[model samples]
Target: MTAPQSPIGAHVPVAGGLATGGLKYAAEIGAEAIQVFVANPRGWALPEGKPAEDAKLLARTDVPVYVHAPYLVNFGSPSEETLAKSIATVRHSLVRGRAIGARGVVVHTGSAVSQSYDAAMAQIHDHVLPLLEEIPDDGPDLLLEPMAGQGKMLCAKVQDLGPFFERLEHHPKLGVCFDTCHAFAAGHDLAAPGGVKDAMDALVATVGEGRLKLVHANDSKDVCGSAKDRHENIGAGRIGEQPFADLFRHPAVAGVPFIIETPGRAPEPHAKDITTLKSLRAD
Candidate 1:
């Protein structure tokens, strides 16, 4: 089968009783791509299932697939135990990602805990680089997702990711997952006129277009630069509709997937959001 027109998808349910069922549901809902967690979103336990068959089913689907690492993973942690577990989890995710034919694996650029900023950066460089080095080229590359400008967050802004790229020595496989809500919350005026274009230009300048792998299409519940992480439905929150249109129409993201992480009580609620995004694509 031919690949879908674009990598436009939503973060459909993949936890609890919805694991495999969610993937099928997403495909049925016209997703060209999809993101799911292989295991519990909060816990550290690895997922238990049949990989070969799951991989076969996922591969036969029309859309590309991606896996989001658990929220508890903090690769930048100063604690040795936490760092070790984080590395293991990342490695496991990469292995599973390859087995499932996933295009990429997503992990948050975590915090430095209560440690000094410099110390935290040092720890990240010393510890995280080696872990990333272990990932084979055949496996999926890790996508560093920046969070809101929260306390002790390692990557609070798009520019703050410079050190991360530097620490990795600008590894070709290391890419970025730019989240709309996070960017807006971190002081990028994505809602204002020229804001979306300016932010995209800044990102291209900082990391270059080649490393721009994924886009997290989320709307913020709080105002821009509020440092909040709340996600609202598309065009219903601080990001508004025009910025999203600009974002989807940008040439940099032409073929990239735009995964929706917005709130929706039912699949029907996502219809409007998906339609809005689809309309932004060029004819």
Candidate 2:
């Protein structure tokens, strides 16, 4: 589903506990869906969820959930230790995701630091393909969210996804988690006329249909093509608001859920964003 046409939610806090805090925050924001960190977002440690909390969240079928793998996960890393840790961390996310009945798990498509892009891509192929193969029929899809066109980053522009699918051989379970600010920062120029449509069309053409499973509804603090990942509140950034309205009208994401990763403490700002997305809907 598209923005207004689909579920609009946010990345809720899991501090109080998965169900205790995440679900409570989701309720406070009027979210129809949510994304969360199964473990620490910045670390490599994989912690098991509380069984009762897992059961509690798993029972709430109304609010669909998603898991974001830790930031340290980078399949393209040249370090063997980092590579192994990345795979294990992602696999952990997949297992945790299924335990909580999550629809998908989002992982950042990472960089090729200090090496050739081809070599880095090879590393991804060597590692990620097998990981993709491990997904059970009932398990969640692995959603790759391309980064801002920052330093050695792979898969920034929509066009960059072509090789990703080709390398994975278009695995049945692989999907995309498109991020608005990231795209804008990657030079998609989404604020211009027909820009959103152009980028979406490019996405479908690059990966084929139905691969876009999620949207990170964010605005950028930096100018277009700046390659900065800073996220601003909706309508308060350089990308403006029209592109998002156009995003809701795009057919490629017709039923995909949109989740905000914007700046906020909780509740109030996220609630306002959910309202903004609802208003952007074609009523």
Candidate 3:
């Protein structure tokens, strides 16, 4: 498929009523793409039910839509029940995403949940490998989102993904969603001069450009390597705007949708942020 010329978008709300309203809001705000939770973000409950009409609304919308999986899923959890639920949730997300014509399903890189590093790694391989094979080729690409270096999180940085990819044997359908705030909190230094470019280069070297599927664009409330996942509005936090401008212009991430996960100041803040990022795109 041809890549988009500009990939700026926002995270529209999916809390009340049908999700069709979210897509309508996104398009009305002039977004070229959008992200939404298929269900409650913090819960593991499988989608209670599917709304064909809602899916139809998404299909008719002009912008691309992506599904952000619930936060409770820890694919690398030491508990067998948690791991099983995580895998099931991922599959359910794929089905829901495909039904809504979403291009990708985003899941956090997840934590080891207090286990030793080796055991965590082993559990990931043992559990995830077989599960991945069950995913159909037509399903939305699984976009792994690296979290901040908090707690026992795996894939703490761009470099940390190498081992996971190696363990998965470099599955072609596997891709990554780079979150700007999280990257900064993981100590990539995007706020420093030339830091954004360097971080992008490091990501390209580690996972290559093809696997870089999406970006979560947000300014950070925490300092670099703070291991906190707090997000602030663009240009309103420590990350600043310069790095985001650099990131917006980078060829490596050009066509990948940059979904804003920042807090809104008002009803139209989402639209304003989309405009700001769109203006930053390389001409």
Please rank every candidate by lDDT, starting with the best: 2, 3, 1
Deviating ranges (above 4 Å) for candidate 1: 1-5, 15-20
lDDT of 2 at 280: 88
Instruction: Tell me each candidate's TM-score.
Output: 0.93, 0.96, 0.93
List of clashing residue pairs for candidate 2: 1-254, 1-255, 1-256, 2-254
lDDT of 2 by residue, 1-283 (tens): 3233688889988886766788888888888889999889899888886745675766955788899999999988888999999999999999989888889999999998878899999989989999999999999999999999989999899899999999999999999999999999999999999899999999999999999999999999999999999999999999988888899888887878999999977778889988888788654
Candidate 3 residue-wise lDDT, 3-54, digit = tens: 4475688878765533545766777677778887777777778865565766
Candidate 3 displacement at residue 93 in angstroms: 0.6
Worst 10 residues of 2 by lDDT: 1-10
On TM-score, the leading prediction is 2
Q: lDDT score, residue 243, model 1?
A: 90
- Residue-level lDDT for 269 in candidate 1: 63
